[model samples]
Target: MTIAAAAPVMLCAWLPTAPGAATATAALAGVAALALALWQMLRRLGVPDPDRAAALILLLPSVALNGVIGAHDTLWAAILLLALVAALDRRHDAMLGWAGLAIGLNPQAGLTAPLFVALLINRRVPLLRWPIAPLAAAAALLGTGSVGWTIGLRPLLHEAITGHLLAIDAPNIWTIVQTLPLGYPLLGLAIAIAIGTIATVIAHFAARPIGDHDMIAAALLCTMLAAGLLPLMHERAFFLADILSLALALVRRDRAHWRIALLVQAGSTLALLGHASGIDALTILGGGMTIAATALLAGPLLRPAANDNPVIARSA
Candidate 1:
């Protein structure tokens, strides 16, 4: 809560007269920043057409929902993109800083931290420099004081442990299995760890030096894994994965990838709309779309690399 509170405080300071205005303004700014970051990442990845890339990003339903709803997720999306840009640029300090801010805002951000670490390792970055994220998170903790942890971390952990945080309301596998006689928390944690490990290995071996494609692919995989396997994930948790998939589709210009992106967007949109309308059927359809999209994308992402394609190779 303390970390998420930073957005409102920062935005409201500039628009004291209207808190709603501040939130809307922040969401707009976050959307713009996210587009810019995506553009930069696509360029860095050697996309043939920048305009198409921008269109693809702007057209994503998840992006549109976040922008219009003025959810804090818009800001988190921007932060994640900026961190990806920093990693692509080989700016280790900047990557760590953005990632730290992400972690401060939501512990879920830690799920993607290993992708950055993989990037650093692929580039042979010093192990000593890796501590920057933890240090920055500690600094955020110190700045917030003990009250932050007491109010924030405790509840978050409790929700996670008891399966209270499961994405049963979302169109996800959890929704299907939730009613079954099983130990949910343990099952969810085991699945998350297993999938996360596979994603990390794929990220490490797929691209030497870790290009934008590799980073984005790894992020998409990890985000999907988290959303599908975490005990208490929300449907909105797939927003990052949806965005990354769109970006990947645009960059790769592959028909199949583009189709996968469309599936993700459709699924996310249905889930969001269904949740709003209290329609369980629509929610199930949405979750099925997500599962299909993730499955389709996993093949290309997890396939053994023939060689590091230099065109999409990392500058670092």
Candidate 2:
């Protein structure tokens, strides 16, 4: 999956510098990554050939969005997610391949999901191998002058890390509400959110009935929300949530939960559409909606099996 996925990125590395080179490179990379991901997913789930077409139908809108919007980061992020899922299903090679795709493109790409999977699988392997890819990629990009030192490596690295400061000059929606008094009320919000998060973690783990995949979905959702909530969150940071949300939808298998999961994707699309404010509205509104939707879709989990799946019944 990684070789096939990264092939386009590798090819783009050779494209003559042009006005749309980066965007074009990103587009090719996105398509390749999406194709590999879908193929791997179809294989892993053993979706019947007929159903496979339907699955691709659901996926096409997203794939098309990635290509058209040049959202390579999120596209690649989704690839990492599929890899992680593949690994969880015991497809370790695909996981490594997905991670390779990330390293070849962005160091921070799907970095968390693979590490999480490593912990779930063989912790030691992820600990040792994950960093190697990005580090080596960085060195190569610098050493081989794929990124020219003057206008490329140094500046790219500098901008990649420090550029956010220039891009984002204020607090995000969550911060705005939390810091209503202004002047970095972040301290209080940070402490409260931390406490709440820790408590949720404890509860989630202590409950123990929660499946490993469920826990992973929850963690991704938490991380996705945090990425957006943090000060100086650029539009790009939301890409971090791409896989986790999809994972949540697939693994949870509750229509309501799936709808909630869709919010992250929606938010991401809004960001690409230059609608950060809209994304903020959706996140805030969507959180409440997800809980209600979950209650309806997954009520059986909280009730007797006789509930007949409220969502499915309603739809019928």
Candidate 3:
């Protein structure tokens, strides 16, 4: 297990030896980190009403499940990545540290770190720092020196390839996928995710020399697409996407963004409800809302922008 998951176990050293006490402590820490990260990212994005906007994420069922109701490390993993994004915006040296920690916590962050690095690299932070995340992930995931490669990321990769289910109340495209052989649906899901990811990258780079707001918007879109496309997903998979919707709304402070945020929160909540109650109707509706939210999330990036690529970026 990664440090994030092992935290509650380790907390036994400082707190009561009971599993419940340690778990509560760890969950509290994750919630606190999440709260602070939401505020800092919103402030850095220049949200005029950070307090009010921060409250919006609390309404997301995924966030509530991961941060309060469960002792899940996914919340901490996401906050660390959010901190890394904030560090890049501030041109701080802590970017690598945060990236390393986030990726260490959740190997999934390894997929998103490089893009953030590419966005903010200049003479200030430079391009050299961009390679560390992948290298660290490779060493942990592929290197023979470690056991993590065998038991950790390997299982995740296996699941991604041969999904255990069509959809676990995730309310995504796969939810609509008819019951078929695992190979066929997993193959289709992979292709769809690849195409969506490519489009997301295009949308991101089209706003190249991307601004902080642009980054937030792109993160919102990308996370939504991931939640909506990936197979074998659960309601909690929308955790980051649901939270980023609020962050994007705050950054834009507009009707459309707010609408999407509200829709995403509601959809994720419904998905969670369906998961708990075994109601396919609720999940189907939630999936529809999720898909709509993702489509709207990409709208802004689809718009025209000035010089996405600066052939000769300004000197620091």
Candidate 4:
């Protein structure tokens, strides 16, 4: 099984069954993973105890809501963070492996794979080592019985194409379009174009050899892009961006990162409330904050550091 999916399954196998036992167990596991990931990420970024504590405090709500109550997100978030930590340590193979396991858990996790590959290639890792990622992903999928010839590509394609075609309650440009009589397919196309354009620009500028900080920045950008651009995304998707941005903020000592993280947290919380209450207004406001935060974050994240040389930064 994909490690994310396997986690709960293994818990069930070993633990006694009771009302809410599974959820409680899953929540415990999620909380543990999140705490470890957060601690490791902070240490890697050289964050001081006070800053680390602040970051953790900022993430606590998300950990409770998404990580504990909504356990599906926990494993993927942990895997993603671990992958980022591996990347920061220059452990290319481990990064790729963790990323692959993430993708196997949730196809959406693949959104960051291209950026990871690009960064690795820019680092001049051997071409031969690159295939490890896709191979690991495939292996995880097969091991999980999530893919087979009879099952084929049809189910996967259908899920990808139709799963989140509508904005539903997500906060993004698509939510605005959903009310304007636009077709869902057309809206999807528009989002695709927008993401493509933004990604192209990021790729152009990100061609330089990247540093650990830059990789973290790239990950933050990718998470924001996915949360903003993807159709049918729920509030939980922002958890990744929120936590990653907090990490970046601690590393860079930039208030902008913290601001964006708070914006995302606020938006996500509102979206969840709206979803539970069936309140359109709350969802709308939440989405607006999310979009604004993403736009604000993109400006500083895309620019090169003013004092550092790209080559020197990369080699460091």
lDDT of each: 0.66, 0.47, 0.60, 0.65
Q: Candidate 4: where is the Cα deviation over 4 Å? A: 1-19, 50-59, 67-69, 143-165, 182-185, 304-316
List clashing residue pairs in candidate 2: none
lDDT of 2 by residue, 25-73 (tens): 7576656555556455544544345234324424634455655655455
Which has the greatest TM-score? Answer: 4
- Clashing pairs for model 3 are none
**Per-residue lDDT of model 3, residues 132-198, tens digit only:** 6556445434432232213235545676667557677787767766333544536465567756675
Candidate 3's C-alpha lDDT?
Answer: 0.60
Report lDDT (Cα) of residue 297, candidate 2. Answer: 29
Q: Please give, for residues 1-316, the per-residue lDDT of candidate 4 as tens digits.
A: 1344235423432454463765576566655565567667777666778334543633456666764454455655667778877887878888888888767655656656657866675677888888887787677567546312122233446755776445667766666666666444665476676578556745644476666666676777777777677666654556676677667676667677778777877887777778678897887888888888878866755555633544225532
RMSD of each: 5.1, 7.2, 6.0, 4.9
Candidate 2 wrong stretches, greater than 4 Å: 47-71, 89-104, 107-179, 185-219, 222-226, 247-253, 273-316
lDDT by residue for model 1 (1-316), tens: 2223234423432454455666677677667666666767777778878656765667777777776665656555666777877777778887887788666655666656657766776677788888888787666555434322222244457756674534646667666666457754555464766576656654655355455566676677666756755556655767777788888787667788788888888888888887678886777788888889878866655555535344234332
Local error of candidate 4 at residue 72 (angstroms): 1.8
Query: In candidate 3, where is summed lDDT lowest over 10 consecutive residues?
Result: 307-316
lDDT ranking of the models: 1, 4, 3, 2
Q: What total of clashing residue pairs does each candidate reach? A: 5, 0, 0, 1
Instruction: Say which prediction, candidate 2 or candidate 4, comes out ahead on TM-score.
Output: 4
Q: Is candidate 2 or candidate 4 better by lDDT?
A: 4
Clashes of 3: 0
TM-score of each: 0.78, 0.60, 0.74, 0.80
Candidate 1 segments exceeding 4 Å error: 1-17, 49-52, 138-165, 181-209, 304-316
Window of ten residues with lowest summed lDDT in model 2: 307-316
